[model samples]
Target chain A: MELLMAVSIGVLTACGIYLMLRARTFPVVMGLMMLGYAVNLFLFSMGRLATEAPAVIGRAETHADPLPQALVLTAIVIGFAMTAYVVILIIRGRKTLEHDYVDDRVNERDHGVAEQGLSKRAVAMPETPASAEADGEPRP
Target chain B: MSSHLLILPVLLPLLAGAVLLLFSGARLAWKRPINLAACVALLVVAVLLLLRATEGGAQVYVLGDWVAPFGIVLVLDRLSALMLVITAVLAIPVTLAMSAGTDRTGQNFHGLLQFQLMGLNGAFLTGDLFNLFVFFEILLIASYALLVFGGGRARVAASMHYVILNLFGSALFIIAVGLLYGVTGTLNMADMAVRIAALPAEDVALVRAAGLLLLVVFALKAALLPLGMWLPAAYASAAAPIAALFAIMSKVGLYAIFRVHGLLFGDMAGPLAGLGQSLVWWLALATMLLGILGVLGARDLRTLLAWQVIVSVGTLLAGWSLGTPEAWTAALFYMVHSTWMTAALFLIAGVVVARRGEARDSFMVDARIASPVVGLAFLAGAVALAGIPPLSGFVGKALLLQAAGFSGDMTIFWVLMLCSGLAGLLAFSRAGTSLFWRGPVAEVAAEQPPMPLMPALLLLVLSVLLVAGGGPILDYLAATADAMLQPADMIRAVLGDRYLPGGA
Candidate 1:
C-alpha cells in the first residue's frame, strides 16, 4: 500500500511539473492544481495506509490515522480558495493586457521602469517592429 | 492560572476583532478602542506569564481537557512568553498609528489587523504542528488582504506572487508534519520528541529528511537568501502599517525554526551529529551576504528597509545555529530589538510617503506639513534602525556579536556582523538624506502641517530605554536563553521529568 502511494505521488508530481512549465496561464493554473493535489495526497500518506478501518476504535475497529485526514481536508479547502483567487487574477490579466499567455515579463518590466523614475511609455521597448504589429493581433 | 494564561493572548484579540466586524456600521470607530484594550491586556498577560515561568517553570494548557498525544495544547515558557511580549509592544503602536480615514487595500483594514494579531498570538502559543499550520494560514491570508489594501496595481500583482509562494510553502510544511507523524505515530511535540529520541541511530535519517523539509519551508517564510525572492517585492508594495506588521510575521518563521530544530530535532542530535548546526550556519551565511547586497542595490527607501529584514533573519539563524547559551542570548536580544526597530522604520516610511504623495519613491513633501513631526520621526527611526549607540538596536547587535565571538567562529561572525551593520547604516543614511535633509517643494511647503513626531519619538525613546535599563532585562533574557538551549525546563514543563533519562 505504501509503495502504491509513493508511485502515485511520483506520477502526480511529474505531471504537475510538466503542466506548470506550459506557456499559457490556464495550463500553469492546472499544473498548480495538480501539484496541490499531489501534495495533499503525499501529506496524507505520511500517516500510513489503513485498510477497511474507522479511525475510531470500537467493535468495527481497524485503527486509522485521523490527524492527516483532518489536516488534508483543511488543505483542500485552502487550496480551493487559492485556485479560485488565481483563476480570477488570470482572467483579469487577460482582460487588461489582452493576452492569455502567462508571460508577465511585460508587466514586470513596466513596473521596474516606473520605479526607476522613467516613463512607462518610454520603457516599452519593442522587441521588434514586426512584433509590435503582432502585439496588436488578437489571440483566440 | 498558568493554564488559563494560554487562552487569553489569542482569544482576547479574536473576540475584539469579531466584535469590531459585527459593529462595522455607524461611525463607531470601535476597532481602535477594542484593539488598544486587547493589546494592553495581552502585554499584561505576557509579562505575568514570564514571571510565572521564572517562578514555577513551564506552563502547558491542553485544550478541550484532553491530555497530551490526544488533544491540542498551548505551551508557554521563557521563549514563548518573551516573544509574546515583544509582539504586543510592536503591535500596539502600529494599531495606534493606523489612520481611520485611510483605505488600506479593499478589506476592512482594522479588522484584518486585529485578526493578524490573533494569528500571531496563536502561533506563538500553539504546541501542536497542525495548529501551527492553522495559525500560519490565518496570518498569511490576512497579510495578503492587507498587502493589497491600497488597490494599487503593483500591490495587487505582488500579492499574487506572495500568495502563490506562501501556498507552496504551506503545502511543504504540512507534508513534513505528516511525514513526522507517520514515523513517530504522534503529533504532540513532547510525545514525538521522546519517540524520536528512542529510535536507534541508524533509523534517524528519515527524521532528518522531514526536518530538512520543515527548515526549507520556514526559511522561505522568513525570507532567507535563496527562498526569499518574494519578500522585498511584496513588502515594498504594501502600505506602511501593514509592512510594519509583516516585520513580526517574518519572525514567526524563525520562531518555528528554533522550536523545531531545538526541541524535536535536537533530541535526535546524536544520530545527526553536527549536521543540524552546520546546515543552519551555511544558510545563515548565504542569507547574510545576499541580504546585504540586496539592501545596497535597493533604490527605494521602503525596499531598502525590506532587505534589512532579510539581513536580520541571517543574524537570527546564525545566532541560533551557534547552539550555545551565549549565542541564544544574543539571538533573543536581536529578536526583541529587531522586531521593534523594523516596525518603527516601516511606519516612519509610511509617514514620509503620506506627506510626499502616492508615487512612492518620488514624492515631494511640503516643509510646513512634513518638517517637524514626520521628518524627525524618520530621522529617529533611521538612527535606531542603524544600531547607533544608546538605542535598543545597538545593544541587541552588540550582544549578537559577543555571542558569535564567544563561539570562536570569528571569521563568519566578523564578516556578517560588520557587513550587516554597514549595510544597515548606509541604507538608513540614504533614506534620511532623501527624507529629512532635502528641502520640500515651495508650493506645499507652506501648507504642510507639522509632522506627527510623537509616535516615532515614543518608539525611539522606548528603544533607548531598553538599552539604558539593559542590566536586569539582559539578565532575564540571558537566563531565558540559557533555559531554551538546555530544553530540560521545556521538556519538564510539557511532560514531567519521569520521561527523562535520569528521572527527577
Candidate 2:
C-alpha cells in the first residue's frame, strides 16, 4: 500500500511538472491542479497507509494518525481557491492581451490595450471576484 | 497578560483587514483614516513587542490555551520581534503612500495591504512549520491581487509568472512539511528540534532530504538564484509601492532559514548538524555574483532595485551561512538596513514615475522632472543602496565583511562582497546621470502634489537613523543572534516544563 501511494504521488508530480512547463496558461493551470493533487495525496499518506482505523486518537490500539488528515484538508481548500483565482486572472489576460501564451514575449503585440486601462485612476474593477477572493484561511 | 502582545501583531491586521474590506467601496476619506490609524496602532504593538523581546526569553502564546506541541502557537523572540517592527515600519509609509489616492486604481487596496501585513506578522510569529505555510499563502494571495490591481498588460504577464511559480513553491513547501512530520512525528519547531537532537539513525536520510527541500522552498522565497527568475519582471511591473512593500517578503524566506535551520540542525543536533550551511555558502556567493551582474544589465530604475534585492539576499545568506553569532548579527544589521533602504528607493521610483510624464523611470534621458527635492531624495536612496561611504549600506557591508573575515574561505566572500558594492555603485551612477544630468529640462508648473514623496522622505529618515544608531543596533542584533544560535531557552519557553527528549 505504501509503495502504491508513493508511486502514485511521484507520477502525479511528474505529470504536473510536465504540464506546468508548457507554454500556455491553460496547461499551467492544469499543471498547478495536478501538483495540488499530488501534494494533497502526499500529505494524506504522511501518516502511513492505515485501513479500518479510526482517526480519533485513543479510539483504538492501532488508530490512524490524524494530523496529516487535517493538514491535507487545509492544503486542498487553499489549492482549490487558488486554482479558481488563476482561472479568473487568465481569462482577464486572454481578453485584454488577446493571447493565452504564458510568456508574453513569444507572441504579444504593443501593450497599449492594458496601458489605456492603466491611464485612468477610477477604472472600473474587472468583472472578476478578485475583490472577494482572498481565499479561505483555514485555521486547522 | 503581556504574552497576549505576541498575538496582536497578527490579529490587529486580520481584524482591520476585515473591516477595511467592508469599507472597500466607501469614500477614500473614510478608508484613509482607518488605514492610517490601524497602521499606527500596529507600529505601536510592534514597538512594544520589540521592547519586550529585548528583556530575554521567547514569549510563547499558546493559541486557545492548547498545550505546546499539541496545537498552533505564536512565539515571539528577538528575531521575530525585529521582523514585526521592520514590517510595521514599512507598513506605515506604504499605508501613508497608499492613502494619497493611488489606491483608487484598485478596489480593496487597504484590505489587501492589511491582509499582507497579517500574513507577514503571522509567518514571523508562528512556531509550527505548517502554520508558516498558511501565512505564506495569505501573503501570496494578497500580493497577487495587489500586483495586478492596477491592470496593465505588463503586470498581468508578470503576475502570471509570479502566481504560477509561487503555486509550485507552495506544493513543495507542503511536501517538505509532510515529509518532516512523517520522519519526526511532530510539527512544532521547538519540539522538532528536540526530536531531531535525538533522532534515530535510520530516519536521518529522510530528515536530511526534507530539510533541504525546506531550504529550497525558503531559497525560492528569498529569491536565491536559479529559483528566483520570477522576481525581476514581477516586481518591476507591479505598482511601485506594492513592490516596495514586497521588500520584506524575501526577508521572510531568509528569516525562516534562520529560525528553522538554526533550531533544527544546529551544532547540538546529533548527526545532522550544519546540514545546509555549506550548500547555502556556495550558492549564496553565486547568487551574489549573478545578482550584481543583473544590476549591471537592468535598463530601468525599478528593475535595478529588484535585482539589488537579489543581491542583498545573497549578501545576507552569506552572513547566515557563516554559522557564527557575529555573522548572524552582521546579517541582521544588513537586513534591517537594506530592507528599509530598498523600499525607499522603490518609493522614490514611484515618485519618478508620477513626475516623469512619458519616460516613466526608463533610464533614458527623454524627459525629466527638475524638482531639486526628487533629485535630493534619489541621491540619498542611491547612495544608501549602493553601499557608498558614510551611509548605512557601507556600515552594514563593513560588518558583513568583518564577520566573513573570520570564516574559513574569507577570500571569495570578500571578493564577491566588494564586487557587488562596486557594481551597485556603477549602476546607480549610470542611472543617476541619465535621470538627473542627461534628461531634457522640463517645466515644473504641472508638478503633482508631493504627497507620495512624504513616505519616501520618511523612509530616508529611518535609513539615516540606522546609520546614526549603528553602534547600539549592532549590539542588540548580536544578542538576537545569540538567542537564535542557542535555542535552549526558546525551546523551554515553548514546551513548558513538561518538555521531553525523543518523547511525544
Best by lDDT: 2
Restricted to chain B, the TM-score per model reads 0.93, 0.97
Cα-based TM-score, every candidate: 0.89, 0.93
Residue A9 of model 1 has an lDDT of 89
Top candidate when judged by TM-score against the true structure: 2
lDDT per residue for candidate 1 within B1-504, as digits (tens), equals 655777888888788778777877624365567767877887898788878877776789989988776888898877888878888887777776664334322446767877888888888888888788888888887787788776665675667667767877877787788778878877777777777778666668777788888889988888887888888888888877778888898999999888767777674446753345788788888888888998888887789888889888988888888887887887888887788888888877766665665334532332323466666666667666767776777778888787776455568777777878888888777666665666553223323222243555556677877888888888888888776656767777677778764675
The positional error of residue A29 in candidate 2, measured at the CA in angstroms, is 0.9
**lDDT score for residue B461 of model 1:** 73
Backbone clashes for every candidate come to 9, 0
How high is the CA lDDT of each candidate model?
A: 0.75, 0.88
**Per-model TM-score (chain A alone):** 0.72, 0.74
List, residue by residue over B1-504, the lDDT tens digit for candidate 2.
Answer: 565878998889999999989877788789888888899999999999998988866989999988889998899999999999999999989888777867877788899999999999999999999999999999999989999978889999999988888889999999999999998889999999998988899999999999999999999999998898889998899888889999998999999999999999997787899889999988999999989999999999999999999999999998999998988999999999899999999999988878776687788888776778988999999888888878899989998888878455688888888899899989998888888778687433354433379899999998789989888888789999999988887988899755655333
